[model samples]
Target: MTPPVPSVPPASQPVFPLPCGMVLRPWREADAGVLVAAYEDPGIRHWNRPEPETPDSAVARIRRWHGRWSEGGAAMWALGRPGPDPAVGLVGLGDIDRRGGSAEFLYWLLPEGRGHGAMEQAVRAVSHWAFTDAGLHRLRICHSVANPASCAVATRAGFLLEGTMRGALLHADGFHDEHLHARLATDGPVLAEPAPGS
Candidate 1:
């Protein structure tokens, strides 16, 4: 007989809180339009996300994130703002492997939200949550070396630079070297200075 499906809803998610007034929750159907617009960013299109995405396509991808959560494979949260403000960022653990106790993490933000130390705040919150609440031993974050902004976010969240993998990630622009960073459960909060006001 086949074994029963494994489940890990406890680590899968709930809402995660961040400093300077932000939170990370599951993606909503209403977020489709916003996601599509966000992806229109040249940096986002060139560095992250699937190529050539439409609003409908964004919705489909968002749905898939929900599926990932249900299957206990990933925790893709929609970064939420305070009061009635729309979400300005995103942060979550991808490639969640329970047996191995490691996962790949990622984050991105809208244009207006850039350069305010907000993503750093979000990253620390998500990483701590993953290492603690999610029962993960280590979290790995990698990005194309060309993206120094992502590297900054990773470091600010306490992820130490492990190494660079040559041609490790393939995108529409072709293979790009990746900077690998990692944080372990035993690590302290290496938060970057001065959390910005909301």
Candidate 2:
């Protein structure tokens, strides 16, 4: 028989702070509308094709992420400043392989939230937590090679480019090559965030 997933302590979600009035916090039911709206972006929908139909269904999806967290399966975080409406994006881990001591990291931000280095900082914070707090040894991230912005983020977060997997990811348009980037617990700190106004 297969052994059960390891027990990480049952706890509240963590909020990681970033500079310039940005933070990464837990997702809430109220954030469903933002999620729905973000997905409605043609770019987002083209890349991420999960369909649950409406904002209400999006809440179910968020709850499902929390369920995975409770089971020590993955950790998910929402991005925004601390306020009534705090979900501008999401960053999370998936396919956590305990036996392999690794997990796949993913993230997305609304168009308005772009320009600032928030995503890079968020990714670095999450990687550190996964290595130190979560006791995971390796984290891997991959994005469509066509998405240079994502590739830049992964590199800035100190994920080393392993290689390109030909046509590894599919979107609304078609298949695209994926660039694999990974970081190990023993790896050095991630690339430094750019100074404000750079």
Candidate 3:
């Protein structure tokens, strides 16, 4: 028999705050434009499938993301600075395996936000929350080898390179190998410890 669904948390819950002054909160309808703009970044398009993100499509996608949270399988959040215009990016725990206490993580930053360390901060914050608040045991972050920036983010967030999946994703260019990085609940420093002698 399939297991009972996990209880859904209240709507619009605040997940956690990143050190770089952003908060990860539940996605809202208002986030569609920001999300679409972020996804439109050329660097973003280079790694994943292109998003056909018209306003209507964004609205539908946001609704679907929210619905998944209610179903107890996945959670998506907007990452932004502390006040209004806060959502400069999106992050989520996807491919949830509640039975195994594991999940996959995905994230992207707005074009303007790239290279600002925002994505790294967001990844660390979300992974910490997933391992703690969400009671997850392991989190995986997979990225195409062509996207070294994404690999850098995973490394900065303390995810160790676990392995590579040969030809795991077929992009517009061609099939590409993907590196799978992972962090576990038992891993060091939930909040990212300073390097030795820092």
Candidate 4:
């Protein structure tokens, strides 16, 4: 189904700052290598099932992400600290149904980006933007049931567990049950702290 026109215009995606010097910003061509590297990590590969990526394919993927934003179907961001070799992770809203006031969250972090609560912070930041700035009323975070880390992130971000979907995602290992978690605009605040400049 078609999403309604996005409240956040395509030309102006906002950057959100997290604690400890991280930020969620739009992906750049220079980030293609990082995307390729993420796909190389066993943990990410096992969970995300990314196609083998050459630099060209990674750049194409980044451009497609930009197009999705322009089409008002998604908003994707690269997670990183400012400086050389910035993006170490990715987080975003996908499958957005703006008319229905809903979207799904997607994310992953590299080894360097892990263990710092960055994923949880990124989720909260994106959820805040989805609800407040994007005019979305509901957001979902669904992951393979085996992915307890994702479950924790979703829960910490205030997305209540709704239920499990049988065989919802097919991983390289096999079909896996998926846990569905959701949060509403009216839900109590889950942010550990206000987003920068909030």
Stretches of candidate 3 off by over 4 Å are 1-12, 193-198
| True-structure lDDT of candidate 4 | 0.87
Candidate ordering by TM-score (highest first): 4, 2, 3, 1
**Model 2 C-alpha lDDT per residue in residues 19-125, reported as the tens digit of each score:** 65788888899988877887787776776655634878888988998899887788889988777775888888988877667899978888878878888888888
* Residue-wise C-alpha lDDT for candidate 1, range 1-198, written one tens digit per residue: 642332375644677666656777778777787687677877777778645667788789888988888887888877867545666767888888877788898778888777667777777777766766667788888999999989987877778999999999897789999999999878875444543342
Report the C-alpha lDDT of model 4 over 44-99, residue by residue, as the tens digit.
99887778999999999999999999888999999999765669999999998877
Q: Of the pair 1 and 2, which is ahead by lDDT?
A: 2
lDDT-better candidate, 1 vs 4:
4
Q: Which stretches of model 4 miss by more than 4 angstroms?
A: 1-10, 194-198
TM-score of each: 0.85, 0.90, 0.87, 0.91
Q: After superposition, how far is residue 106 of candidate 2 from its true place, in Å?
A: 1.1
lDDT of each: 0.76, 0.81, 0.77, 0.87
lDDT of 3 at 70: 74
Which candidate order results from sorting by lDDT in descending order?
A: 4, 2, 3, 1
| Candidate 2 residue pairs that clash | none
Residue-level lDDT for 165 in candidate 3: 99
RMSD of each: 4.2, 3.1, 3.2, 3.7
List ranges where model 2 is wrong by over 4 Å: 1-10, 190-198
Top-TM-score candidate index: 4
